[model samples]
Target: MSRALALVFTASFGAMWSFYLLLSVVPRYATSHGAGGIGAGGMTGALMGATVAAELAVPRLVGRFGYRSVLAVGLVLLGLPALALRAATSLPAIAGICVIRGMGLAVLFVAGSALVPAIAPPARRAAALGVYGLVVGVPAVIALPLGLWLAERVGYAIVFVLAGGAALGGLAALPGVPTRTRAHAGAEAGRGVVAALRSPALAWPSAVFSLSAMAAGAVVTFLPLAVARGSGGLAASALFAQAASTAGARWWAGHHGDRHGSAGLLLPAVLLAAVGLSALTLVGRPIAVVLGMLVLGAGFGVAQNASLALMFEHAPPRDYDAVSAVWNIAYDTGLALGGAGFGVLAARTGYPAAFGVAGALVAAALVPAWRDRAWLRPVPDAPHCPRGYR
Candidate 1:
């Protein structure tokens, strides 16, 4: 990979690691502070809502401030929440920190994603995105388990400090990247969100992204609780297994998307996710849960990379900010909806029924993939391109 691409990946890895670490510890911290399941779930939901709000604003922010400046600000903002969490002794205070942290996550994701496409050559864009996803997945895979372990050994405060340090590390890497300024940067500056909705090509991939995100949200919010029940207690082994499966699957799927066109992989990835959800519904056995988690993780990783690549490839270069906003809105909306809706559903029915409903929703994602497969054809060449032109 090129040096620019490497830097993007490195920065993304650190940022995402910090985000995941906080996510892993938030529930434990909440419970320790006397919050229950509903309260914990609400905090997670609030975080997603905050991210959506930030995503809605990112296009304008990127236009006004530029990507590099936006990213730097985002990294610093991410650090603040960690410090806030360390001092938070009440549910409202913790929720407020989550909201702040969510805003930082929103900015980082949008700026970083938009930056990747600008820095990468068009011909290799998909591959570059795949590599980027792989890098993000690496730290994500370990962040949760490690965070949980550290929290258990040292305490949640220490985990928050470590996560803050990671955010600082990511911020330190940002200055090394060269800034890209678009030609129509002014005209394109405030148009990303609207343009994304108007373009069916961009919207379709986002739909797929949203559905997959929903499945992931379910797992993240409830899998630990489920495991605790199944094991008769919360064991480190279960947490480690879940984190490993998620991270490992993401890394592998990113490579798969890089090798094959995203369209070729979309349906199968969605189907695999559905199957994983189905497995969880059918059998609550520990080994089965682990296996299902692996399937779900792989599907999520591949689908996310593929969908993002598809959106970027179809989007006009000038619309990067808008496109990034659209992608994040879809993803966070899915997460928020899934966490809140599934929590209600699980309460009304049970974990098995909740898993089944989630599986069904994921299965529905394949319909659009099948129908829109041809819509994602490779970009046509300019009239006077090279000899390999078809």
Candidate 2:
């Protein structure tokens, strides 16, 4: 990797570690503090809702402030408030902290993704993104489960302290990363998520990708709670398997998408998520639970890379920020909806049936995933088009 690209990855590592460490823990924390299932969902919803709200303005922020400034601010926002969680006893106070962190996550998502294509070679962009996935995904694999384990053994206060320190540590790499992407001037300066959504090419893939993200949100937020009581080890193991598989699948999908086509992978990716979620309906079986998560994680990973690579493949270099923002908005929006909606649904229907319904909902998205492949059909002689658009 180029030095600048390495620096971007380094900075992103800290942001992602802090985010994932608290992702599963925060909901559980709320539940422990007497918030109940709905309240747990509310905490996740608040964070993701704030993230979606922040995403809308990030393209403009990056356009005005540049990558380094926005990224630096993002690190602080994501890191600092996590420390305050140790003292927060009320649900509202915790939600307020989550909102600030969510805004920080929005900036990191947009700026971090936009910087990749700007710095990497066009022919190997997806391969480079695979590396980016590893950088981000490693945290989900390690910290996601580790935080839960640490919370059980060490206490939430220590987890909060570690999360804060991880993000603050990323600041040391900021000076090495570039302030602006090469295409950040002129026409690109005015483009935003609205413009990107107006284009069917970007919208279709984003819509398809959102479904998998929804499933992911539900799994991350409720799986531990849904498992048989006192099976905390099982929950942690299932999550670890999910994150590890996701990281591996994402890395593989990026390379494959670069060589073949990202669009073709979208259909299978959605189907896999559906199948995995369906398996979770058999929640009493430990083997089934782990296998289900693994399958689901694989699908989610492929969708992550395929949807993103497809979007970046079609967009002009100048529209990177807008495309990144729109993609991330779809992502976080699905996560918010899934986390909040599933909790309410599960409260009424029970976990098994809720898992079934969530699976069916993801399966319903197949229509869009299938249609997106046609919309993304390859165009000969177009430099921005991918071989797999067909």
Best by lDDT: 2
Each prediction's Cα lDDT score?
0.72, 0.89
Q: Which residue runs does candidate 2 get wrong by more than 4 Å?
A: 186-190, 368-373, 385-390
Q: Can you tell me which runs of candidate 1 are displaced by over 4 Å?
A: 182-190, 229-260, 365-374, 377-390
Clashing pairs in 2: 261-388
| lDDT string, candidate 1, 205-323, tens digits | 78777887787777776666656444523434444554555555555544554455555666676677777876777445777777777787777777777777667666677777788
Model 2 scores a TM of 0.97
Candidate 2, residues 36-113, lDDT tens digits: the string is: 888998889999999999999988888778789999999999999999998999999999999999999999998998
Per-residue lDDT value at 295 in model 1: 80
Question: How do the predictions measure up, each by TM-score?
Answer: 0.89, 0.97
What's the residue-level lDDT of 99 in candidate 2?
A: 99
